[model samples]
Target: MPLPLPPLFAAWRQSLRAGYAWKSLRGDLSAGLTVGIIAIPLAMALAIAVGVAPQHGLYTVLVAAPLIALCGGSRFNVSGPTAAFVVILLPITQQFGLGGLLLCTLMAGLILIALGLLRAGRLIEFIPYPVTLGFTAGIGIVIATLQLKDLFGLSLAAQPHNYVEQLSLLLHSLPSLQVGDSLVAVVCLAVLVLWPRWVPRVPGHLAALAVGAGLALLLERAGLPVATLGERFSYHLDGIEYPGIPPFLPSLAWPWQLSGADGQPLQLSFELIRQLLAPAFAIAMLGAIESLLCAVVADGMTGSKHDPNGELIGQGIGNLVAPFFGGITATAAIARSAANVRAGACSPLAAIIHAGVVLIAILYLAPLFSYLPMAALAALLLIVAWNMSEARHVQHTLRIAPRSDVLVLLTCLILTVLFDMVLAVGVGLLLAAGLFIKRMSDLTDTAALPKHFHHALSDLPEHVLVYAIRGPLFFGAAEKALSVLRRLSPGVQVVIVDISAVPLLDMTALAALANVLRDYRAQGVGLVLSGPTAQVRLQLRRAGIQRVDGQLAYVRDLPQARVKALRWAGGSKT
Candidate 1:
């Protein structure tokens, strides 16, 4: 049975005490504070990348981090805005605006909760390794491209949505690049690249942000033409204030009041919702993949087992709640989680503390964020892109993986770049599944033996046939077994199927066996099953094939099967 949803407050209380040791509390607090500092800039930068306000990113960290830590099974997982979600959410927000995007996130959260309730958390493990690599690499490319405009402060005539068009526009705008912005970006990039080597303990990205912000401020005072956060956005709470509550509330939104660019109500048509369903599903799938993958990484570092199902539920609840607060989609942040562990977090309480830190920053430090330059944020994301791409893994996959996997990898990469993440993952999964079925079918085989009579075998009767089954009997291999059974000669008094060598049988294989039995019985042949594995026997019994007349003669060994076959042949004669 599937596990029930855990009580949220109870989980929070449990998390506070989990992994508790007086020796580790001080270290955990230090680590939590360090991670909080690192996550602040990243959370804001990812929010910008997704076309949302920086505060929304802080909202995600505030709500998602603690909620996931409390309800999730992972000891050190910090959930919030991640680079992977940026690839998916940006297009959604671009196409549908923030309202529709919020609805999609809500739907995705519900889907994730359902998956957790259905105990489908382990399903993420089935995603092909190449497919993940391809989309990740493609996402990195997209993120890098998005950063270019900010990196150079290019003033394009228009921003394009597609990657190719975006690049073309960026190229066209190269002449408009501001020298001041370029200098700031270069400095930020340098600090991000070099600070880690020297300060090993301090986060280089945070240092880069500080340096870049200072440079931008200095340049602004010196009368250089560069953009700051204040130029791009203005915060207004009077228009439509979202309900503010603790992070434990379920995410909900009334779609009626949200408006589009035309000042009209947002589209709430069923068709639009239906169209958005695929994207929502894609978001949930990628969330599952990225979150669970991060959790696994945390497990390796912390030497703790994570409940994948519980984590999925927590993610679902976090996402479900976040959209109402004007937050975009979220997932486990691998970089942040690793930092939390390295900082010496002892338990989930450290994650909760990190969330508290972000909330404090959001409420008090909003204006200070206005001084942060877009170029510096871009540089920060550039580092994030580089890390997420895992170029070394990409090269390794190309060298060691099979041609088919490489083909899948390449296809997913191209589709993600040319179209969208939904299409890429869909096509990649289909291709992978098809190749797997083909491989399994290739490994499956069946053969029939002709009837033989031996005088030395006096115990044996005439008109008896024996057929042997080997290898896994699954959907891909069922056809071969059926074909062999169909080829059995007429007038055979007894047909014995020897299945001892068959290691597995799925629903399709069981159905094939039933059809063969029914066909042989109609042809006046006595059918005997022999030497089935324990699992195979249980399956047959469950499928109502345990009895043959008043006798149950399923055998456990070859010798017993041979003797049973002889008796069946003799009984037919009598």
Candidate 2:
């Protein structure tokens, strides 16, 4: 039977049992705390980047991290808001508002759970590498562009719905950029970029936040026109509030309320849900890709395996539950997982603890976040966008990949930027598959050759012939093999087929060979196959071709095959 759990999970279990050392517990605890510290600032930044209040991002980490750790199969896998989802979710939030976005996330979670239970996790590995690279590069570009507003503090009449229009608006607003925001962003970017080199071990993002917030406070006291988090956002109890869950979960209808422009209940439509389907699919695809990629990376660092399906199920459940509490889409975070592993995380417990830390921050420290400068968050994400781009990999793919593969990479990249991720991946995969089939077909060849006995001019020879077969006979080569045999010289007596060179034959090839043999027999040519490989012999035998006497032969070598062909040719004359 196939392995019960996914390979990643199986590996994880093996690692846990094999490498369980007491010394590692302290390291795990230390690492978990370190990762939690780094995640706090990032979680807030990511939530804002997605156009939601910073608290929602914290909520995602708080809700998702524990759920995934408890139910997931990876020991060090950390689940929370990620940069990749920002591009996919932002548009959904813009179009559908928080409710529709939450509903989409909920649907995506259910889809993931279904996929996990169906054992479809391994299928994620089959996603083309070029597709991943392309979409990721595109997402990085989108994220960087999205941060421009805060990065420069541009004042615009409205945010553009599309990337191009956004850029156009940003360029037009360059003169109106807030000097205070610009200075804060520049300083924050500098700190994030340089602090790691100096501090070496301290959480760089935390340092950037401290420095940026301090600078903003000092600037405001100095009478500078800086925009604080408080200036940008206000916690209006009436704006967007988390709904209270009853003691028992209420029915969908009881809780299904859509907000109107005037704060009254508005009628909901099925069309709104239908429009969200594409974006939801995009979220699910990206979540699956990023989470699995993070798991694979963690496996490499920890020398442990993760359960991809279980992880998917966990992610789905987390995402499904998170939006109800004002959370956006969430996934495995590569940076946080690396930090957790590097800090010596011992088990999934560390991730659970990390979630607890985030919860504590949310419950107590949320008000202090109002002092955070928007530019600092933008600077943080700018660094994130740069790291996420994987420019080195993109350059490498372009330089080293084959022309066809490069074409696929470029196609996906352009489509992801010009249209959306769904179109890019769908088209890129189809094109790549088509190109792969064409390449395979080009490598296959088939031809017909005369039997060895037919070369001899004999007195008793009236009609005699032999044919040779070679090469891998698979689906790509089957048609050529059969077509060549059909055009063989007519008026032949005995036909011996040389199969000494055939290394493999699939069912399609076998069927093609059988059909050609049947056609040859109809023309009165006695058919025989000689020198079949051990595998080929077994296949022919199992296919009942061995039972067809005088129609097939499995010889030990070419000499025996030649002798049999001579006797058959002589018999035809007699």
Candidate 3:
């Protein structure tokens, strides 16, 4: 047989083959601009949330967005810096600085590409819904909590690492809250919450930021202090210092050349890569899960199927190339993709155009963005955190889901908040697996033939008995399912085991059956395997179980096996 073709750039090819229409182009254009406007504030906010300059987030949009759009498997997937990474990235940025974070992103890109090549994308579907909800809810709490320092304008001497520490620090800093910043945050958050219902056509992020910036400006005129992006972050070019983001595109440079935690260039070596591997895996895992989940959502909205492996490869390529251009980690943003669908995007071109919009903003609107109040960005992220939490769904699941599922969910949530995502996911999966084994083991059974069957076997010997085995026989269930055979009556001279209903037989089950056969033989009893499926018969033969001299027998039907058993038991056969 010929080898199957690789799943690469399938989205682009399929979109073009569907025949582009002018109406489609118009929809794409509108959707692109609308989502792009939404993305500008979001990209910057997410980067700031990760403890980096806002320009790094814009660079992610400029590089990764177009690359993923052109090569991805979902036509409407919008890729950029996302809020989910805030929990994972912030710690990395604090300990290793921007350089380490970029290196970790690069490593994650390679891992994603490997996963695609290995065709492991379908495995992502097996992750339970409760687990995803748990971690996401936990992350939302973390992100919202992180925003508090800006939201309340609290001054912190140092940032803490864990959620509890961060919360404690925030509470302690409550005395230092700036009234002007708090006022701006409240106004922006209120607009963000109310504007979606008031003017659904306009993006809330844009309106909220505009109003918040205006409020901060008025406060500044009143001789009150409110932190703005320009005052907090700055860029340098041609030996001249400039406040806010630079009005230019990201240029190619090694990630290790960026500033480390000690304010020096990073030393790239095997030890550094090894130290970063764990976080890199975490980033790649989260990225793959988020991006694929986003694609599934897009598919549901548009009634289109996506090539998951192709999507992974696209995301890998985007991340692999983006780091050199000063971009941080990125993935498909669910909110932005949903907005794309609602705005009538029909192909990947809409996402690419969104990248162009970000590029334009970076070159021309950088200075204006510098004037945006940090409090306004905090408000935007607060809304994101609330939405990401999916509070109603969580509550519903807790109320209606199985107790074990609820346990898993809560465990994951607590672990994520107290420790980290990697540990939470690992423990949750193990717990889920153990519970699944118990459930499946309970489903498998070996039961005696019903009393009604005895009516048709009137001539059968009293020394013969029949039992049926059902369900898959694996390690978790094999011994329990076969325990009934071990309790056979002493007077029973022959036994028939019906395994036609069994669908699978693993080694553990085969071993158990072998032990049962050995015990039955020592008791001078005849064993008849009745109506075993072909596959089960193959397993019996491979395990050295076959017809012997009046000791063992295999029959194609249950009636034939009964007749044989009767003869062996010296009973009158029908």
- Winner by lDDT: 3
Give all TM-scores, in the order shown: 0.84, 0.84, 0.97
lDDT of 3 by residue, 1-574 (tens): 9866668888878788777899999999999999999999999999999989999999999999999888778898999999999888998999889999999999999999888888989999999888899999888888889899999889998879988888888889999999999999999999999999999999999999999999999999998899999999999999999999999998899998888888899999899899899999999999999999999999999998888988998899899999999999989999999999999999999999999999999989999998999999999999999999888988999999999999889988899889998899899889889999999998899888854676645556678888888889999999999998889786989888888888888999989988888888788788887878889888888988786555665787888887778878888774
Q: Which residues of candidate 1, in runs, are more than 4 Å off?
A: 1-22, 218-224, 236-256, 261-272, 447-467, 482-497, 514-529, 538-556, 563-574
Error of 3 at 546 (Å): 2.5
Give the runs in model 2 whose Cα sits over 4 Å from its true position: 1-24, 221-223, 237-273, 447-475, 490-574
| Tens digits of lDDT, candidate 1, 75-119 | 778888899988788877777777777788888998988888788
lDDT of each: 0.79, 0.76, 0.90
Question: How do these models rank on lDDT, best leading?
Answer: 3, 1, 2
The numbered model that scores best in TM-score is 3
Residue 59 error, candidate 2, Å:
0.7
Which is better, 1 or 3, measured by TM-score?
3
Candidate 2, position 182, lDDT: 88
How does candidate 2 score on lDDT? 0.76
**Candidate with better lDDT, 1 vs 2:** 1
lDDT digits (tens) for residues 18-54 of candidate 2: 6767776677678778888888889988988877667
